[model samples]
Target: MEKTRAILVDITKCIGCQSCEQACKQVHGFPMETEARLSPTALTVIEEHGDKFVRRMCMHCEDPACASACLVGALRKTATGPVTYDGAKCIGCRYCVVACPFSVPRYEWSKLAPLVKKCDMCAARQSAGQLPACVEACPTGASIVGWRDEILEEAERRILGDAKYVKHIYGSQEAGGTSVFFLSDVAFEKLGFAAAPQQPMPVLTANALGDVPTVVMVGGAVLSGIYWITQRRVAVADEERRER
Candidate 1:
């Protein structure tokens, strides 16, 4: 089998330059800069925690809750490590948004036909023998990509070699592991990292969804349909108003 990929983020080395954020915007064609948080237009963002900066993006969970909650399989965790989204297959059901532990998926509220958005870790670039835009733009080697196992080994090496480093690897067990990992000098919580259960999030989602009555499931589908129609009408009305 071909090897899977992972990105190890060394928080200790990051200078908070925002180069990765800029490169992500350029590659994704996002004209507006979202300096604060992830949006449909912004795939990544770097936030300050005192002197330390933390980058946020899709965790690409090994068993993604977003993929599990997707009633229409629009979000899928690929074998190669990225969690990819298919807008064509998306029915505008934002269950993925609610299901995500990291709140990574963004819905385009202003668009006539909105799609969920997040980082795919530049899967196309990897296929073409290029690094992810964000990873390549990082000058201090804060973000480095490699085979998942190799990256895990590297993470451990850094922790062991340096006494100043935090003893924990953020993504190593979070949500039963993710394509992205973070290393830092201080406790993770102090750096704005969300507390994640070590158990795979999808498993929790599946159990919860399974217990719902069939009537509720049907009602959910109806509600999703209604939501799509409502969004379409609202967007269309706005366009007409602008024209008038």
Candidate 2:
């Protein structure tokens, strides 16, 4: 089996160069923009958090809520540890957008027919045994990619070895663990990180979805009963008119 890939982001090492952002745009054939945000064209962004630079992108959860929210299976967590989207399969309902805890997915609002967009962790590059474009483009070694287990261990080592680290590994357990991990000197909440539930969202989504069949069956029965009663009333009214 292919080992799950992951990325470790050391916020302390980042210089806010925006190299990763530029690289992502270039690789995806998106037009260059002066300001980068988590938009349809820009899959990632580097936010200036006072003296620190925070990189924001898809978390790629182990059990992604976006994938679960996709009724048509347009979004899926691949075996290689990236959450990928199939534009053809997408119905443009935007359920994934609402379901994502990280609020990472973007839509091409300007396009006639738009599709949801987010980082796929450069799955094509990884399949060819190359690092992700952003990780490779990083001038500083802020963005590092490796196997998930190894990366987690490396994040631990950095925190343990350095007194500057904040001691919390963001994404390690948030939203049921993500493929991307972060080591920050400042509190993640101060960096605009959302407070996410520890439990995997897929569990909740699945439980809700499991109730769909029952709900549909009960609804159908009630609607049928109402229709039958209405038809009987109409028939009785017609018979009374004929007798009169």
Candidate 3:
């Protein structure tokens, strides 16, 4: 299998230029917005944190909770490392939105037939041997794309070499590791990053879904038995009436 691809975000290097945001909008053909947030049109956004600027988008988890939560398999994790969505298969259940730790998935409320939207790391471009739009547009090289393991190693190297960066590597183990990694000088919490559990969320979701079949079987048997008894009672009453 091909090694999973990933993106390294160096928060310390970001200049709040919003070039990444512009690139994302241009590629997706979304209208330019003054304030971008996770929405059907806006796939990525840059948020300011005091003196720091933090870029936010889909983390593209190794074991994505959204994919697990999807009943129709609309959301899926690609082997090459993007959590992609298939709108044609989507039933608009919005389960992915509720399950995502980063809350990256957004719904189109205005559309007659809406689809959930989030970044897929520019999967089409990656397949064509190109970097993601955001990464390509980053003039400061704050956003970079590479193999997951290599990116993680590079993030550690930078942190070790520079005193400005915090020791922790965000997305390294958060929610059982994500394709997108972040290096920051300040605490990640201050930059609006979620403190997710180290274990992958799919484990929990799988356990719950695994019981569904057994429940359905047991419930069906109980209902059938009740109906049988009811029918027997009615037959007995009719016979008794005829005998009387």
Give per-model TM-scores. 0.83, 0.86, 0.87
Q: Model 3, 68-163: lDDT tens per residue?
A: 989999999999999999999999989899999888899998999999989999999999998999999999999999999899999999999999
- Would you list the rank order by TM-score, best first? 3, 2, 1
* lDDT string, candidate 2, 119-186, tens digits: 99999889998889999999989999999999999999999999999989999889999999999999
lDDT of 1 by residue, 1-244 (tens): 7678999999999999999999999998888555688888789999899999999999988889898889899889899999999889999979999888888899999999999989999998988999999999999999999999999999999999999999999999999889899999989999889898898987875666677797598999999999999999999999999999
How well does candidate 3 match the true structure in TM-score terms? Answer: 0.87
Candidate 1 lDDT trough over 10 residues, lowest sum: 202-211
After superposing candidate 3 on the true structure, give the runs of residues whose Cα lies further than 4 Å from its correct spot. Answer: 212-244
- Model 1 alpha-carbon drift over 4 Å, by segment: 32-34, 207-244
What residue pairs are clashing in model 2? Answer: none
What is the C-alpha local distance difference test score of each model?
A: 0.91, 0.93, 0.92
Model 2 C-alpha lDDT versus the unseen true structure: 0.93
For model 2, state the Cα shift of residue 151 in Å: 0.2
